[model samples]
Target: MNNNSNLFLCKATRNTYEHRRSSLLCQVCGDRNARNCFGSVSCAPCKMFFRRNLDFDLVINKCIYDGNCEMHENSRHACRYCRFKKCLTVGMKKELTRPPRLNQKKRIGKQITPPLIRRLDLLNSNRSKLSFDQWSILSNVTHVYDQISPLPKILNSLSQSSFPPKKRLRIDGATLADMLGLIYRSIYSFLERIPDFTMMSIHDRNLLIERNLHNVGSTSGLLILRDGDLYSNYAFCRANLNTYGSDNFEGVSKLLNRLDMDRVAVKLFVVVLAFSTCFDVVRPSNMTNNIQLSKSTNRLHFNTINMFHIQNKYIDMLFIYMVYRYGYIEASLRFAALLFTALQLCVHTMEAANIQEHGDMLDTIIADTTRKLNVEDDPVV
Candidate 1:
């Protein structure tokens, strides 16, 4: 047969295989075929669909049922919006996305600043070239974040909320919602206090805070999990699930199982997250026809160039720190593992936000907090 006929037959064969495999049912659809995509179990077609369309900000179909469409293997394609929501609902982790090409720098060559160029030089320089100020800044950022939102306090809260291993666990949805807000607020407040962050425009500052809040929360959540609370799976601090009417025990358990609990590596990873520029506003995809690179977007992009260098510099410092603490091979492995964790955290945070019943309410809280901060010139505490 010709190429088109052969391709049709191949697809038909795969569909038959999918129908025969009951054990591989997709979570997004009831298809008897599934493949692991991101962090969730999904069928190959669903996985490919999600891979191509994960960014919600991009223009897409509005669910006719208003995001309440029924999904089954045959009907899953009926509503793209509801289907994507289901993808997140079933815990498909976005961080599981294959790393994008490292050619973003090439797209923004004209936007690169002189300061950023110098920082890149410093980043490429030998470990021996590191100066005292670099260490001081890195140390200070870590210290201040810890001091502002003490991990011990979060761990202590988890311990307080949790019951004995054998006891039945009850999670208050309201409390979970409140805790999520608290964590986001703490992290946003911390981000604002990053040295020279205040120098940026208010719009850009808020944009950055909103964009990176999930990552910051994920880092905080992982840190809390790294403590002894993983066994309990009751995250009252970062990603709280309400066990009142539903079961999240298995999901939370799986999440904790996925975390890499290296304290030093995680600390450096948190610094990396603080400087993440992976937001739709910052890095709109080439496939995102709906998103326009307006003048404001370009301006924000330029502003973030400095921020990117700052993050890159810290990342370099992390590489050096890891190399110093562990041998080269181990450090490389740890860094890779940490990067995966960071990616997982990004996906986890998004899923967590959707799973929580109070997700939109929490966004409202952040919005109000942003307005308050913007209106009042009080220093971020």
Candidate 2:
């Protein structure tokens, strides 16, 4: 019994081997395994079942028996729905079926050449020269700065019915700090837009910014006030007066009244503030140095030659515009007034810095300018 059984097993193994298919049982229906069809190993009956009813109707050909119908080779054809489901359960990929190829002829459109773009060497070509305008460069630079700077939305003046006399803003230390921070940040934005400002050495840039940043903010505030853009006692934004307590509002109101500068005057003042190069624009005392040389000329001996050049360009543009707008005498008076306002701004900045609450904000302005210049703890000259 043992010998016959061993001989029969050996013969069956040889037959399965000669058939060029795995002797392992089929994964789908537990029948004799064949070559892989799609992605899974299954017998011939399951493979044919899958291909024939690849898109079989599950509802119409529903299994009368439980979904677990016997899917062996002999019984696979009895339920096309269950057989296909078993094929998928065994990991057969339906997407392996290839789509039919179309035999339509391709039509090509007529070839047309693209128009040639002429390249001119701007460095050598006279055709690339910029035409001179009285204030085009200055105007363009200021316009770009104005576009990026954070100024308040222009609202109608306090006299306009739009600004109803609402209750005065509640002033807190936090609100005061925020207002001052906004002003300094706006000035920093304007400074960044100056041509060659970032390109200058970090030391020169920081010095130039620290020297004149206060005046820039002041000039912006003055411009807003002079243009009647402030509502009630607030500077451009209503938050401007939220920093000033009831006690300080009177002083602020008086200051705003004195800022009667025209648009041209305000622009010239902004240009002046942008170009200030003196390291100590906000001096402790009335300095004779500013009176004698002017800030730009004073910085000539230092490594701020690049800064001086850029500043001089703006200064020259301002002077030319002033002369064009007004005769020399009137221009001189306007220039003097703007210069005085810069000095006044320095005083105002100093007073604000001396306030206990503003001390941290002043430090923040220095830290921010240092970070913007990409300088380390100590910048090299």
Top model number, lDDT: 1
Output the worst ten-in-a-row residue range by lDDT, candidate 1: 279-288
lDDT of 2 at 33: 57
> What is the per-residue lDDT of model 1 for residues 1-381, given as tens digits with 9 covering 90 to 100?
699999999999998877766478798887865766789888888888788666653253344334465677655644456778888889987777866554566557646644434554543445354469867876787777667764444444443423442221333566555555566677766666776567766766666666666666656666655442333332332234333222344444565666555565566677677676663222212224555668446534536678787778888888887766664556688788777656655554555566546456556755776776688666768
CA deviation > 4 Å runs, candidate 1: 1-130, 150-169, 228-260, 279-302, 376-381
Candidate 2 lDDT tens digits, 1-381? 999999999999998777756576677778875768778887776676677556666665444335676666545543345677788888987776433332122112223433324442231233223237535665666686557544332221211233322322223457546655665677767666655665666656666665666657666765654333233233223444444444344444555656534565566557666666662455322233355556544433346566677767766666556655664556667777767655665566566555666656766776677676764446577
**Number of backbone collisions per candidate:** 0, 0
Query: CA lDDT of each candidate?
Result: 0.61, 0.57
Query: Where is the poorest 10-residue window by lDDT in model 2?
Result: 102-111
